[model samples]
Target: MNTRLLFFLLIICPLSAVCQTFTSSNLPILVIDTRGGTILDDPKIVADLRIIDNGPGKRNNLTDKASFTSVMGIEYRGATSQQFFPKKPYGIELRDSTGINSVAKSVLGMPAESDWVLNATYNDKTLIRETLTYDFYRKMSKYYASRFRYCELVLNGEYRGIYIVMERLKRDKNRVPITSIKKTDITGDAVTGGYILKIDKTVGSTSRSWKSPYPSGPRNINLDIQIDRPKPEDLAEEQFQYIKKYVSDFEASLAGSDFRDPTKGFRAFVDEQSFIDYLILTEVCKNVDGYRLSAYFYKERDSKGGKITMGPIWDYNLTYGNADYCEGNSYMGWAFNFSRVCPKDDFVLPFWWDRLLLDLDFARKVKEKYKALRQTVLTPERLGAFVDSTSSALTESRQRNFVKWPVIGTYVWPNGFVGRTYEAETDYLKTWIGQRLTWMDINIESFGVLTALREEAAFTLGPNPSIGDVTLKLPLPTPTDVSLSLTDMQGRALQTRHWPAQPKGLFERTLPATDFNTGPGVYILTISTQTGPTSRVIVRE
Candidate 1:
């Protein structure tokens, strides 16, 4: 052994201690010798790691030459799972010779990355929930989802059962694919682009975070928002303020009266398609923590689709009928409505989802997108095939894992249902997915209907990105008096017009540019009728 290896062993374990060795099977085997040091929640410890994989159709033995070897730093990962589960997930950092500096290396055909995660899948007896969820997101969404590989882990002298080596979520060309923020890029367009934020619990490590200015949906709770990228320490004051304000502005517009406006509403700041996809994924799986926690959204630079986009989905072990609480196991309801289902839960979903559904256009798009996805990636047959393939791959490894942990027939905390066998667990998952898809297909049309009644009375603004004058095409059901008023973002009225005894047909009126001193900004035009008041957003360029 080298001097450093010898020193590590001496400091971490007894001199006479003999580490256990194992022969692997069909799957890639990862052997980690931590000397004898315990992996903690924070501050990783140095370790020696080796991987034995002889490629496809080949079996690896402990005595075989290692395909890859590295000096590494390993630590316990996950929140509740780390605290309660004996089979714990781990965070890994590939280290250089000194065992201090991180070095990126590709493992098991995955892209090179210094940071990676070994998910223990303690709660998921089938051991495919996280992998399946990530795969589904990757197939359906344009955004990058974490890539994962299944492997059996041996820590010190003990076998750690089946664990997935997955790419950690971060700013990388193959990961989040957002412009990296730098200290110098703290002004103008440079500062505006590329930010990653998450709404999650603030119980762990200290990181720079802010609270939502608006309360969570009917829960009256302000969500704790954390800056995921640009590392909290590296984030400049200007960068922090810029992202913070941008989110706040999005919330403000989403909550405004004319929030449905395509140009001035929440649509102006967010990618509607991403939000739609996210909603579909969450609802399809009934993820207990969806939206409220582990939810990620990123904004690229203005030149590159500047709108804030949701995804690169993370932390999905508690999804797809996996959890017992908050109607998580049910395939009948929308996951975004968790606040209403579990009002007393400490974490509440952000108001953005409910408000977004309130917009007719957004709801229509969501329905259409879900309908389209069902024909492709979200189909029952395709999903079932993926589950079966993954189950087959892990058939041998799972027996070994269950022998080590013995959680197969028993209930893990928060598990909605416990199966007597691994096959049963997977069957339940498939059944749940089928039911969920059917429920969504039958009920998703309601989203389009929920806001249509209110929108029917609203007028449509034409030449929306109007250069000068704009036309309003109003469909009146009956002759009545109508009052029109335009207001700025701050709710300050800019212009007012009245039409008395308007015909029941479509009424078209052109508002002259000179009527209001317009430059470049967002204006809300409200039309008050006897039935109710309706509003539309107008953009002045």
Candidate 2:
């Protein structure tokens, strides 16, 4: 056993007997026995793991029968967390009876997987930062996010406080849902996909990584992309070169002058919707480490929307007004502008976000998506309920957890706000979210030339697939100044007409098709009022 582990057990074990014995829990109970072995950063030690889950609304006790039991190879996880925090997180791999062969079994209600993470959210006092962020991302995007369950852990007779057993991000049908690649898949379409790459600090990662061809955001910092799936040993040289070149080409295209060109530019290389959704989530939370660190991107087979897509966001413990640095606590400002905010930070946000916003269509889509989400998943009422329910569920478990590690009312590094109680922490989180949402609503509009009006009923445009001239109708409630403009799909202005003081109720104008020299394509017809701008798709036949 290492000196640190030995010392910890020696000091803590003797004192634990005097403390309250953990008897029962409202949450699931995970008990692990290391069998006198020490848990290190690597070269996992053999451990016996058992889980006791009494289902919802039932109490789980240490004396109860275990629902699942297995031999597991366990090791300490996290880079800075392992170094700084005494309450350690763990990475576990299930093993068979021989303790050598791998095994897969469903733990709690999650899918059967051998690889798992026991995240000790020690820095996060509320203990719901990752859970809340993942849940919100899953609700917002169609992509798969990690599923987790909160539980109490007892390691070698020592009650180790609250930990979340979460699905580790990897290639699985129930997880990333991408094509599986092999060493033999070195040619044709097989060589093209499914690669999972992560941009992160390489402190403890053993995965093979490559530096980006482009500098990150006006800085000389080179972003490193690590291959997260298909272990480096299993990958062929051709496969490695192919993915590397593919990412290189994407960067080149995005940086090119024709980047805005839909067919030939960056648009063809990426899934725009995924990027937009990622932007919204990161900005909404004002994640300090977002975009630059722990960022993930994946590509599937060419047949399956082959573009590089941003997704499956990870490590957001420093998000939602959590961190004190880089304006993270502020409810205002964009997270994508991290380079401008911090400038000298080692990790820098890529230039993709700034470049993407240059496209009017992409900006419009982002605005529309944000507006839609605000009406549904992101409302204050819905979010507040989530926080409340989560807090209520952890009511019993939290007391034991706090007792194990009394961090409340004390300052942990990078904490934006230190609340005296759990209630205060939750209340601060809720208030920050509400303020952040409002700030984003007002700021996101500056992305493009037009700010979308709240009321779609303000104007109407018809004969959409117009054979000739199309009529635009505006039923103004009050006399208003309006400017009507027609533009090609590329945003080149075709014509503009202005009325200084248009009379109220039913004003009409005919937009002649002959005036649009551009033929047989989609066009944008925008109406600019004192309130805001509203745009509609007008097809020229």
Among the numbered candidates, top lDDT falls to 2
Off by over 4 Å in 2: 1-18, 450-541
For all predicted structures, in order, the TM-scores are: 0.80, 0.80
RMSD of 2: 12.2
Cα error, candidate 1, residue 394 (Å): 0.8
Evaluate residue 89 in candidate 2 and report its C-alpha lDDT on the 0 to 100 scale.
94
Q: Compared with the true structure, what per-residue lDDT tens digits does model 1 show for residues 1-541?
A: 2344323322212224334223556898888988778888888999999988999989976657889999999999888989999888899999999999999899889888899999988998888888888888889888788999899887775567789999998888988888987978988899997788888888884668998988664336777988888787788999999989998999999999979887889989998888988988888888899998889899999888888999878888888899998678877666765665555677989878867776767778888888989988898788888999999999888877776777877899999989999999999999988988987776665555533354455568878888888998777655544566676776455676655445567778898887557567888776654333467888888
Alpha carbon lDDT of each predicted model: 0.80, 0.81
Residue 495, candidate 1: how far off, in angstroms?
42
Error of 2 at 369 (Å): 0.3
